[model samples]
Target: MAFVSSERIIPISDGNGLEGGGAFLPITPTPNDVWNGWAHSGAWIIQNGFNGGGKDNVTSAPSQAAQNSVTVSDPVTQHTAADPVDVYTGAFLYDGPGLKVGNGEAPMALDYRPHYSTNWRLQNTAKIGYGWTHSYDIYATERHASDVDIHTASVAEIAPYWVTAQYLLDTVTKIPTAKEVALRVIAARWATRQVLKAKVTVALGERRIEFHRLSDGSYMSPSRFRVALEKSPEGVFTASFKHGNSIEFGGPNAHASKIVDQYGNECTFAYADDGLASVTDAYNRTLTFGYTLGALSSVTDSTGRSVTYSRGSTFDMVDADGGVLSFEMDTYGHQEILSVRDGLDRVVVVNLYDVFHRVWAQQPLGDALKPTYFGYAPGLAHETDAWENPSWTKFDSRGRRVQTVDMLGNVATWV
Candidate 1:
């Protein structure tokens, strides 16, 4: 017989902050007992009758779908050519199909999985076929489980005539609400999903601008000062930057793009079958890159300056003039420490970081190390070097850093 260690046991909380939701004493599950006996047991003994869990030895559990159906108070209206219908964007629960687990020889137990469906109109115009239907698969068990693991799928269809409404909205001058801005942003993001390497023209009053998505998840615009979007794997825009006056994505290869500035200066990129080979800039200067065993080996800059890199325990790079730069990475692939050296390999600058990968201090070669301290509130940094100089930074409700107050009461405001 095997016994589980006391350290391996986890104490589960009851929903009402009281142990077992004021029903019984908290049940601490040992690893061995939880894994071998109650891993997939229909209703946990501790959670029974506390938060919708059925009584002991009950075959059928209560349907969460029938219990928790959310009704939206203010749903959006989807107007069609025939009639306008109300679209619900809130969760409407339903009983999902039973999931078969364990061996086929064993009796199949009913899995009480509750699913929800949310429907919303992506485009507010009178277009008939432009909307989104979102469905989610939610788990019923695990009291501490947040709503994050709810698997969601969004199905959207954009009609050809939908562009007319979008164009009109772009040309019209009106103060949009927070909801309108959020809806428009989601609509723009949805429009670019799965449409890789294709040009789409939109007429905005007298101007016709072409929008296209690259293979590497970037968008090109026909307008001046094109905005380049870097998207994540989920088709969400992570970062956006202004490119030159004109930008075009290369063919099958993602890296072979070109950008031309307002002054007719151009920069072209070339790539090998695997990676980038060289970049020729507007001034006819070339920067070449080299790879070794599928890893970046060297980078030769436009000014004929070269930096060669080697990877082992840490990444070490040496410039052509013998200056060295070494980096130490955390498990999450973030550079925790960066050390810069001179020609003689003497450390010139050292950057340090906290566990969350925030840069806390920087030490120069000849100066005394003055460490910087950061105070965080929720998601934004609220203060920096506050322990030493007593500075306080404040952010707005939108998480934007608004103002900073130093030790001398000097206030700096950001717009």
Candidate 2:
């Protein structure tokens, strides 16, 4: 077993044993400030909301030693889903002792919009508000689309603590779907809010289904606690959470209620399966679940050798039975890989889909709501800090408030 200590950024040492050659310097925090730059300062804001308006929040400054680089940390202090505030950007720079590095004398803008926060967060928020007019080709899965979907252009608004992300989803000529149409709204919000949370509502004509953050803080059961649309209008609507995965239904027939899991696990659900394969819309597909306890399990792999993990539940995927020769859950319990033998035109193929999950914050809808699991600056080391938020900042070297990047992708100047 090999274990190595992790540092935020590799410090550059000049011949004189001094950090040099950059506007931002990666420094190591010493004692007395153990949680200085390392402590989480706020929640993460997601960009996927109703109509594509996604945003996130960040409270602390980036590390000096890790400037222009990514430093995974925790959420801001006292953050939650219903806080009514949004976050768009954050940094991991060093600001010495006081909270503000330059006290608005300088401000660093974080950018580089990517598909998922996980992607850009890992790469560090180095690429800010990029790819608005960039053209790109995307590969589509058989289950998602028939061919590659081309993207034309996209744009976003860059803010000190907020960002507004926008993307022109379709490059090829085609009318957008309700989902696509809705993304526009989400995109708009994501562009502006610092931390953005949205309730995704699916409207199948008069029959509409909606999903939002587990706001109520009551998580007795994932299945039992959910908001329902008794009478959905032709347009879209957002719902509110009460507690424990429970929701308050709106409209005339609306009532405070909850939902039960697929397998009937009431509260304190446990994940119990890997995954299974089937057909959907007359095409081959797979359904992965968010592991909940005692949901369902199957044996596959000819000899039935496999590993499995635990999760809340699986998303629905419709496919044919024969195409799926076997199924087994990996040791992880949350994901299960399916082996489709000869189903791919005599080609042995395996397709895996990972299930995503969300945990609601334990706060009243009336409170400043936030998600427990996700927040702006969400990462392996990031945590939320609601007590003292990052109102603004300034970089050290240039003594300028605004940080400008050089052609070489370096922090060119702290203006």
The TM-scores of all predictions, comma-separated, are: 0.40, 0.18
lDDT of 2 by residue, 64-106 (tens): 5325632223222211121211122221111000111111110
Deviation in angstroms for 15 in model 1? 35
Give the alpha carbon lDDT tens digit for every residue of 367-389 in model 1: 33443333333312322331344
Question: What is the lDDT for 158 in model 2?
Answer: 24
Going through the candidates in the order shown, the clash numbers are 0, 132
When superposed on Cα atoms, how far off is each prediction in RMSD?
24.5, 25.2
lDDT of residue 266 for candidate 1: 60
